[model samples]
Target: MFLRNQWYVAAWDYEVDRQPIARTICGEPIVLYRRFDRTLVAMRDACPHRLLPLSMGLKEGDNLRCRYHGLLLDSHGTALEMPHGERVTKHLCARTYPIVERHRFAWIWIGDAELADPALIPDFWPCSHPAWRFDGGYYHIKCDYRLAIDNLMDLTHETYVHQGSIGQPEILAAPIDTRVEDESVFVTRWMPDIDPPPFWRDALKRDGRVDRWQICRFIAPSSVIIDVGVAPVEAGATVENHDQGVRGFVIDALTPESATTSHYFWGMARNFDIDDAGFTARFKAQQGGVFLEDVDVLEAQQRSIEANPDMALRVFAIDVGGTRARQVIDKKLKAQGAAAS
Candidate 1:
């Protein structure tokens, strides 16, 4: 089961233009599109009449026209018109979810509409900040959303998985600073004054080793904001000197589609090269490739878990971050369930 009463990424701002697109969030089918005012509208995809998905319809002006029976529905799911039917039922409206469009993403509330508060939405400031150039895409991940959360919380795997790009032996040797707060967790690992990976080395174009950091913040029910970058060894790589080197923020937002599938929205916001289109292209492509590696491993692990349900997982010192994340998620679920009861 998924935690409701939360805002989940429905789609990127540009993905839903005039045409209707269907996406399953939290295992519930819905259709998404933009109104004439460029506002996002999300509603239950199935028509109450014959259970035909409303997404199988056309966008007529500001409303959605159901193709099967010629039913026109507004953004609020109110039935506007019907084919040759004199009696237009007033209460025949499709279920609609609350939508908040900001930070270049469309967020939808999948729970009690009354409890859908915009303040509950997590903030990824760089996505909308002008000083950073942000680029990212969506991935259809065939694994549990929690798997991605765990993978992100414990990034030591990057040492082996990303050897050709961002990985280095220094990562595994570094000690992590893990902290838990109300509804959130932070897993930070700083590798001070080490040889830069090929990606950062080329980007920074520095002559010698540098100090790097991976400060990951995990928000409950699945969202992570990772601040990553490196500075010259002489610059100290601290908060004040971070601007002296190339740095970026990796923002991850996940929406669960099923017990074994999830929708992943991720991107990087870099402050160093705020206006370089070429760098943006390369950054997005290389970053996408890096995430593909993660997806491959996660899918394989999912298959293994399915094959051996009783298989026990061994935890180590490095797993403390992930273990704590899981505990926090479970606690949130328990509290939410009890409140609903």
Candidate 2:
């Protein structure tokens, strides 16, 4: 029930290197590696012979060799060599995924290679901008990808789940503004004349009243870009004031691993303090901690959902953005399903 003809973040550029990295996406096991020229390649994890994971094998030049048997497979998943034989079999070729590395993440197309256009990938350019410094980590969450998407679309949970680090009561009390343009859901909340959240207060040196903005945008399938910052409450939302304040982009790239698990690639991309190495490293570490707080709540919520699969949870007025986001994805899925049929 997931969108197949789309680009999903497979891993950060630095995550995979000489050794093959094994990952499961959309219920299909995949093995990722790099070529001599550093071009990233993704292929079926299971070897065609005996079904041993190719990841368990070693890299042989531009190809991968099966560990169980001396079978060498090329990047295109073609069997190039076999033990005690010098024959290339056509039917034993492994399935390869169309992949492209963009904005520091390797994006893989899950279905229809012909439809996998590089332009279809989401533009998270801010993460790779020269003026911005970005860092994040991946979390293997035990939940449906939609549940994680719902978590990002609704900011109300921050006050409760992330109370220790990035939460404040004013966030929940702030009036929400939801808008949908071109099938993208945008949820904005402006908390004026309130104490800054812990992260912003420390980063921006704002001890008193501050105006904070949590602008969350939900993309198709399951990706989110959260534009957040805080400025002096009296300065208003001017370009100059925002530049003087602390600003950052919370990039959440989500991909479904199975029917009940997800691969969450989250990062913090910021425009300020790029020259300060200590500041950059510390910020990245803190942001990772804050996200783990969310992990706790999301995993707990998933357990509850699994326990009562037949029971429907009640919706609240605050769920407008999350509900709308789900609707847009559902519509896309329906259209894709009909087209395929």
Candidate 3:
């Protein structure tokens, strides 16, 4: 198990309301509930008083009432009242985890409490900008989280793996540049003078003129934001004009449920001024299918790794981003170990 000290997505902010939701992160079961003031609280799911799952209890105003013994727990996880005892006071409290809600997701800190900082959380650019239309969803995959991270960092696979959906075969041999910066890896590819992919074909034609294409970015350990735009194609020379269309931004994160299980959270934004609910839902579904395809391959790879733990895998130059990501993870885990010492 890796002691990743970064923000991990716990649940959708809207998923936790009046009711208490139970979630397990890094093998720790936590129960999350919202106070009347709208602040969220997370405590160990087990009640210290009777060792019962607190999630089985009820929410009463600002406290959670244990169903077995009717004990009321406050936002601080302190045992405020016990129906049978008058001597019990604030001394009894469950373990509380630091939590923050941002970008439509709840982030939980499973590491050292002092290191938990809301400001340190990664920014989901699309979620914060009003000019972008955002769509988000989740998926449960039977794969090691590292595999998912590797898959995202390696974009070359898209040409073959996602050929029908999001990939362009014409750009299969495009040159790619890779770089690593402070726990993040970036991969960029520039494709010029190519026919627009199906999704961009219609959007690229402006007043009967086709445009040039550029796919510029990919960030890691688990996020990618590509800027694709078309300009007029004339006499083998690119003419700068208004963008045919733009794929606003895409942000994705994979949270590990265990050594061989993960939860994927993804969000996409578009610059176009289209916000019909039905259209958004359909788009989300289409993007979700693409994610499912990745999940299938990742899970299979994970299973193969499990079956042959000692097998050495060969890597090519195209795996530069993935190699960098693994190095970052190794460095973080090593630093965590050194700090513990």
Candidate 4:
């Protein structure tokens, strides 16, 4: 079951403009656009008149005019005019969702409007922080969002799936520590005084022994922020804090499109080389390629799971992080269901 009360990333800020874009979140079709003020407006994709997708309708100023019946709707999804008459029926309004643009993403609350609070949105501070440079792309993955989360929370797959990119023998040799703090799940691995992976070595721009770290944190309902980087051995970087060297936060926010599909918003925010535009572009492309590998593996895993209907997924020691994350999600879902009932 999907968590309806949480804020799901609808699209990147640039994705929504005068032209409305259609996105399905938690199985609800939504149309998102930016008004004249550049503020976001999210509403049901279907028109209130005849269920025509409003995303396909024409943009009349800040309003949307249904192409089929010519039903005009304001930014708030309120009917302003009818097809043949200027007088529109009162109370004929389409459902609008609470949307807020932050951290370069438009987040839509899919549940009770009154409960929609901007403060509840997931913290993606590095993306907006002035000291960091962040950029990435989106991926529509054909797999359950949880499977993507599972892949992220457990980095063992990196040794296989991303063998050519960021994977290293040190990562597999390092011991992982999994812990839960309230609703957050953390899986930390520190590879001390080892050769940095090619990705980190290039990011560091040096060729010396370094202490590498991968701290994967799961922030429910569906986001994993991985703190990764390396510092020269002399710099003495620790697992607690690694700002002494070039560090990056791998930002991943997954929004469920349906039971078997997800919207993957992935990026990296780095504290060092904040002014290097070339690095940002090149790295974004590289990161995109790496995640595409994940998408391929995840889609195959989903198909395998579907084919083996009688089989169950087996969890092992390395799966503690994902297991704990699933538990946290289950607990929140149970609470949400109990409250609704």
Write one digit per residue (lDDT tens) for candidate 1, span 1-341.
Answer: 89888899998887898788999999999999888888888999998777799999988898988888888888899988876775788688999999998787899998999999988888888899999889899999999998899889888999888889998889999989999999789998888888899988988976698988998888877889998999998876684347679889899998899999999999998887678899899889999999999999999999999999889677898888878888888998999889989
lDDT of 1 at 213: 90
lDDT of 3 by residue, 133-165 (tens): 787788888887777777776667777778776
Q: Assess the local accuracy of residue 333 in candidate 1 as a C-alpha lDDT between 0 and 100.
A: 90
- Cα displacement (Å) at residue 122, model 4: 1.4
Task: Estimate the Cα RMSD of every predicted model relative to the unseen true structure.
Answer: 1.3, 1.7, 3.3, 1.0
Q: Any runs in candidate 1 off by more than 4 Å, and if so which? A: 239-241
Candidate 3: the clashing residue pairs are 211-231, 212-231
Lowest summed lDDT window (length 10), candidate 2: 235-244
Runs in model 2 deviating more than 4 A are: 238-241
Q: What TM-score, computed on C-alpha atoms, does each candidate reach? A: 0.97, 0.96, 0.87, 0.98
Sorting all predicted structures by lDDT, with the top scorer first, yields: 4, 1, 2, 3
Backbone atom clashes (below 3 Å) for every candidate: 0, 0, 2, 0
Overall local distance difference test of candidate 2: 0.87
Which wins on TM-score, candidate 2 or candidate 4? 4
lDDT of 4 by residue, 1-341 (tens): 79977898999887888888999999999999889999999999999989999999999999999999899999988999998896878699989999998998989998999999899998999999999999989999999999999999988888888888799877788899988998899999999999877888887888989998899999989999999888999997788878998898999999999989999999999999889898789889999999999999999999999999999999999889989999998999999899889
The CA lDDT of each predicted structure is: 0.88, 0.87, 0.72, 0.91
Q: In model 2, how large is the Cα lDDT of residue 20?
A: 93
